[model samples]
Target chain A: EPEVTQTPSHQVTQMGQEVILRCVPISNHLYFYWYRQILGQKVEFLVSFYNNEISEKSEIFDDQFSVERPDGSNFTLKIRSTKLEDSAMYFCARQGGTEAFFGQGTRLTVV
Target chain B: SQQGEEDPQALSIQEGENATMNCSYKTSINNLQWYRQNSGRGLVHLILIRSNEREKHSGRLRVTLDTSKKSSSLLITASRAADTASYFCATARTNAGKSTFGDGTTLTVKP
Candidate 1:
C-alpha cells in the first residue's frame, strides 16, 4: 500500500534557527496536513494545505510556521525560528476523502 | 483545539480480553478515525466512522460514533499481545481537512 513519507526522521537544531520538515504525501491524495505532538501531549493541528494553498490553520500555527507545496509531490513545513517548546514529533498526513494516512513523523529537537 | 480527549489514559488486560477506549470531541465533525501506534513507529489507520454512521467494524475492531454527544468509542475484541499499543481518536471537521488527534489510550496486553 502507498503511504506518506517524511524526510529527516530526526533533527537537532539550535534555538532561533530555522528548520524545514519535508513530506511526500500519497501521489493521488489532494489534501495535506501537518500536526505536532509534544511529549505526553495530544496531537495538535498546525495547518492544512489544498490546491497549493493553506486551507486552515490553528492558533498554534502562528507567524513562525509556514507550509508549502513547492512541487507536485513535496509538502514542507518551515519554522522560521525554532523554540525549545517547538520540539516535538511532527507528522504529515494526507487524505483522500475521509480516509487518511500519516507519515512516520520527524522528531524535532531544539536546544 | 478541536482535538478529542480519550478516557482511561492507560489500560492493561490479558490476551484474548477486550479493550475499550472512549473519545470525546468539542466540535462538529465530518468523520472520526481511530489509529494505533506501536512505540516510536508511525500511526496505522484502523477504522473510520462518518458523522451519519453510528457504527463501523473491521475484523476485530469496532467503532461507534455519537455525533449528538460528540463522542466515539473503539473496541478491540479478542486482543492479543501484539495488540499492545497506544490508540488514538482523530476528528476531521467539516470546515477543514485537518485532523486533531487525542492524547491516546495506552493499552498493554499481557500474554
Candidate 2:
C-alpha cells in the first residue's frame, strides 16, 4: 500500500531558528493536512491544503507557520521562528475522501 | 474547539481478550474515524464511520456511532500483544474540511 512519507524523522533546533518539515503525500491524493501532538496531548490540526491553497487552519497555525506545495510531490511546512512550545510530533496526512492516511511524523525538538 | 473526547485515558488487557474504547464529540460531524499509533509513530487508519452509518467492521475491529448522542465506540476483539498502541478518535465536522482529534486512549495488551 502506498503511504505518506516524511523526511527528517527527528530534528533538534535552536529556539529562534527556522525549520521546515517536508512530506510527500500519496500520488493521487488531492487534500493534504498537517497536525501536531504535544507530548501526551491530543493531536491538533494545524492546517489543511487543497487546490494549491490553504483550505483551513487552526489557531496554533499562526504567523510563524506557512505551508506550500513547492513541487508536485512535496508539501512543506515552514516555521519562521521556533519556540519551546513548538516542540512536538508533526504529522502529515492525505485524504482521498472519507479515509485519510498519515505519515510516520517528524519529531521536532527545540532547545 | 470541536474535538472528540475519548474515555479512559489508559487500558490494560491480556492477549485474547477484547478491548473497547469510547469517544464523545461536541459538534455535529460529517464522519468519525478511528486511528492507532505506536509509541512515537504516525497514526494508522483503523476504520471510518459516516454520520449516517451506525456501525462498521473491519477484521476484528468494530466501530459503532450514535450521532444523536454524538458518541462512538471502537472494539478490538481477540487482542494480541501487538495491539498495544494509542487509539484516537477524529471528527470531521459538517462543512468543515479540517478534522479535530481526541486525546486518545492508550491500550496495553500484555502477552
Candidate 3:
C-alpha cells in the first residue's frame, strides 16, 4: 500500500531558528493537510492545501507558518522562527477519498 | 471548534475482550473517520462513516454514526494485545476538506 512519507523522523532546533518539515503525500491524492499534536494534547489542524493554495487554516497557523507544494510530490511546512511551544509532532495527511492517510510524522523539538 | 470529542480518555481491557469508544461532535459533519495511532507513531486510517450512513464494519472493527445526535462509536471486538493504541475520531464538515481531530481514547489490551 502506498503511504505518506515524512523526512527527518525527529528534529531539534534552536528557539529562534527556522525549520522545514517535509512530506511526500500519496501521488494521486489531491487534498493535503498539516496537523500538530502537542504532548498529552489533542491533534490540532494547522492548514489544508489544495489546488496549490491554502483552503483553510487555524489560528495557530499564523504568519510564522507557511506551507508549500514546491513540486508535484513534495509538501513542506516551514516555521519562520521556532518557539519552545512550537515543539510537537507534525503530521502530514493526504485525502483522495473519504479516508485520509497520514505520514509517520516529524517530531519537532525547539529548545 | 469543529472537532470531535471522544469519551473515556483511557481504557484497559483483557485480550479477547471488546473495546468501545464514543465520540461526540459539536457541529454538523459531512463524514466522520476513525484513526489509530500507536505510541510515538503516525495515525492510521481505520474507517470512515458518511453522514448518511448509520453503521459500517471492517473486519473486527465496527463503527456507527448517529448524525441526529452528532455522535459516533467505534467498537473493536475480540481485540488482541496488538490492538492497544490511541483511537481518534475526526470530523469533516461540508465543503471543508480539513479534518478536526479529538483528544483520542487510549486503549491498552492486556495479554
Candidate 4:
C-alpha cells in the first residue's frame, strides 16, 4: 500500500504568523488534497490539486491560504497571517481510484 | 452547500455487536466513501461505493448506497473497541471533484 506522510504532528504558532504544513507521498503521485477539521467539527475541504495545478478550492480557502509543490516531491499548504480560528487538524490526502489515502495530519494550534 | 450529513451524531455499543451509520447528501454524486478517524489522527479509508454500485464490502465493513434517496449506510459487524472512532461519509460529484465530508458519527464500542 502506498503511504502519505505529514511532518510536525503538532504545531503551535502565534496568531498572525505564517505556517507551512507539508505532505509527502510515497512516490511522485498525482491528485493531492488538503482538508481540515476543527476540534469537534466536521472535516472541511480546503483545496484539491490535480496534475500540477490546483483544480478547485473551497471558499474557506481565502487569500491567506495557498498550496504548492515547490520541490515537486513535497506538497505544502501555507497559511499566511494565520488566525486563531485556523487552529485545526490539517490533513493531506492522495486520490486513489474512488477513495482517498490520508496522512496522520498536522494539528495546528494558532495561539 | 453542505453536501453530506450523518445521522445519530454519536453511538455506543458493546463489542461483537453491529454498528450502522447513515449519511445523506443534497446533490448528485459519482461516489460515496466511508472513512474512520481515530481520535485526533488522520482519516482511514473504509470503503467506497460508486453511484452505479449498490453495495461494497471490505473485511467486516459493508457500505450500501442508494442514489435515488441520496443516502448511504455503513455497517461494521462484530465490532471491537478498536473500531471506536469517528466515521465520516464523503461525496464526490465527479471523478475529479473534491470530496465533501459529513459531520461524522462518533462510535464507541465497549469491550
Best by DockQ: 4
Where model 4 places Cα greater than 4 Å from the true spot, the runs are none
Q: What DockQ values do the models have?
A: 0.69, 0.72, 0.75, 0.84
Error of 4 at B23 (Å): 0.6
> Clashing residue pairs, candidate 4?
none
Supply the DockQ value of model 4. Answer: 0.84
lDDT of 3: 0.92
lDDT of 4 by residue, A1-111 (tens): 538999889999999999999999876668999999999999999999988798899999999999999888899999999999999999998887767888999999999
lDDT of 3 at B72: 98
| TM-scores of the candidates, chain A only | 0.96, 0.96, 0.96, 0.96
Flag regions of model 1 displaced more than 4 Å.
Answer: B1-3
lDDT of 1 by residue, A1-111 (tens): 448999899999999999999998867667899989887777788998888888889999999999998878899999988999999999999886688888999999999
Ranking by DockQ: 4, 3, 2, 1
lDDT for each residue of candidate 3 in B1-111, tens digit (9 for 90 to 100): 446999889999999999999999998899999999999888989998999999999999999999988999999999999999999999988544888888899999999
Q: Which model, 1 or 4, shows the larger lDDT?
A: 4
How far is A86's C-alpha from truth in model 1 (Å)?
A: 1.1
Q: After superposition, how far is residue B56 of candidate 4 from its true place, in Å?
A: 1.0
Kindly report which residue stretches of model 3 are placed more than 4 angstroms away from their true locations once superposed: none
What's the lDDT for candidate 4? 0.92
TM-scores, all candidates, are: 0.94, 0.96, 0.96, 0.96
